[model samples]
Target: MWISRAGWSVLNMLQLIFTLAWTAGLIGVAFVVLLVTRQRRLPLRMAARCWVPGLLWGSGAKLVVRGVDRVDWTRPHVVVANHQSMMDICVLFRAIPVPLQFLLKQELSRLPLVGAYAKAMGMIFVERSSAREATKRMREAAQLVKAGATLCVFPEGTRSHDGEVLPFKSGAFQIALDSGADVVPVAIEGSGKVLSLGGLFRVRPGTITVTIGAPLRTVEIADRQLLAAQARESVVALKREAA
Candidate 1:
């Protein structure tokens, strides 16, 4: 079950360094974007492109996605998925070829270069510990959707220690309600085993599947609890399918 921990650590460190360089590269791109257009979507396509090799070669993680065709890429949508590890973000970043706005924790905005990159990438950050702050962030996410941006939410709120699906947070569903955005349930498998919560600087070289489920309509759910339940059910079904 254990991959080469020492070798993985070295590779992981290299990824971290590369991410720093990538961040710097993005800053340059952002500057160019400002000079080129009024749109703030400069990091959309490039981020996804840069993310490919960053996870594939940087960590030896290959990706396989299913149900991607089920989605209407031309229209805007919200993506809901499980959070198993930090590697999950990198995997999704690469596999998703579209412009994505991530709903991330506010603390992540504190990271030096990564934070800057996240901002440039149009990530929506929330203060999880504060209900008010979290609400404001959700509203901001809604606005992003209104502006024709696709958002990704890890409804589990945090990474699960065991592979079992945890309770879905209502915030993601709530945003769907406010934004009138379709929810695309995504299931990410094998990432948890690759880089567990046990420690950082860990990786397992193998295929990681990011399966997108059929879009769930927000208006169909009458309540928050129901919305959360449906989101969880979608993720559970996705996991089973991935299994």
Candidate 2:
């Protein structure tokens, strides 16, 4: 079901239209919910639940999730996963059962409707322009985790080009340490084949598998790097298990 570049344009444009219209409609619902409930980011989790089914249908990617019982969703968690495609975002939202928040880099926060959705969801946007700004955002994220919020982060920082899991970054592990939350490594396969990095227009229908690993407990600062390495290893292992 892979689409040629020329053949993808019309469908891409149509997807764009659906995305914008759907996002706008959801934003309106989020606004009213916010106005009444006054709960920050409740709108985000709500919107995420609504966004997943559409993306899966539009991409023609059937989802197969595994290891749900591996970690307890009742408690807060720092969920880290490998990034291969933008569809991974929606996939995670669908895979995880709880209301989740994300760690958005500065650039994604400025996307027209997407940014507004993140803002409404009360997602933290990290500014990489300077160490100070990034630290500020990380601190906020840590605080959120400490308050029992489930935050999803792609520790590789960005999507991989060839579906390989990239090297892990320290920020997510640090957040786990700072917040005393367990780190959950999740592996996603087949999403890259569905919608690849910079291959937004060339979508194909396929099955995407999500495997969640056991939670890694946060010990102390001395284990930060070790924890990150272990998380990466777990992700790789989970990817194999999923495959």
Candidate 3:
């Protein structure tokens, strides 16, 4: 016997609640470990490798990743991706093997435990309203990349409501150019079906395909906007390929 759409929605909501609880518990433990050891690497890695993947599994999302081997694990990269859903974060964390620091909105820095963990992990927070502050934060982020931390940024700045790749923001490209790091373009498809923007507690079991495009060379690119455009094009192409 098959379940009705309403029944399936109820089941999905229950699954999402369970996943959120499990993830919150893990983050709490990770925060404690960060405080005890004064070492953020292990806990951050655990979040990427374990917690994120667990969230996907618990939500019944099958992740298919391609071109992961193409990523140079030894060097820091400006990881740029088209944002679709909140699940895009989980997919990126699970697929990328190297340690990653997110370039998040400054508002996220105010959350209690989660914010504390993010700060400890050296995540870059930008106050977009202030141009000077944003530039300062971007410079700091570039330095972090130079210091061997891959910086992941959703250049779209917000989740796409219609699954279309939005125009790229220049901040991520600027960071890559300033740090002399390559820009790795990533395409995340099918996540919008799982948990789209404005869906809140709504989620569904589905497959997410992550396509990692070839790293764009920043050394030869003199224009940050051009680089951003190129990265967007790569993501758009990869999205088509995923389709």
Best by lDDT: 3
Over 1-243, each residue of candidate 1 has an lDDT whose tens digit, in order, gives: 554757667767877687567667766776577558856565566666764565567656677888888888787788889988887887777766577879999999999777876786678999988989888989999988877888898888889988788999786777888888888888999888767677655556677898888988877875878888888898899999988
Residue-wise C-alpha lDDT for candidate 3, range 58-102, written one tens digit per residue: 777899999888877788898999998878877888888877789
Better of 2 and 3 by lDDT: 3
Off by over 4 Å in 1: 1-19, 22-31
Each model's TM-score, in the order given? 0.89, 0.92, 0.93
Worst 10-residue lDDT window, candidate 2: 196-205
Q: How many angstroms is residue 165 displaced in model 1 relative to the true structure, after the best TM-score fit?
A: 1.1
- Candidate 3 deviant stretches above 4 angstroms: none
For model 2 the TM-score comes to: 0.92
Clashes per model (N, Cα, C within 3 A): 0, 0, 0
Q: How many backbone clashes does candidate 2 have?
A: 0
Tell me which of candidates 2 and 3 scores higher on TM-score: 3
Where does candidate 2 clash, by residue pair? none
True-vs-predicted CA distance for residue 109, candidate 2, Å: 1.4
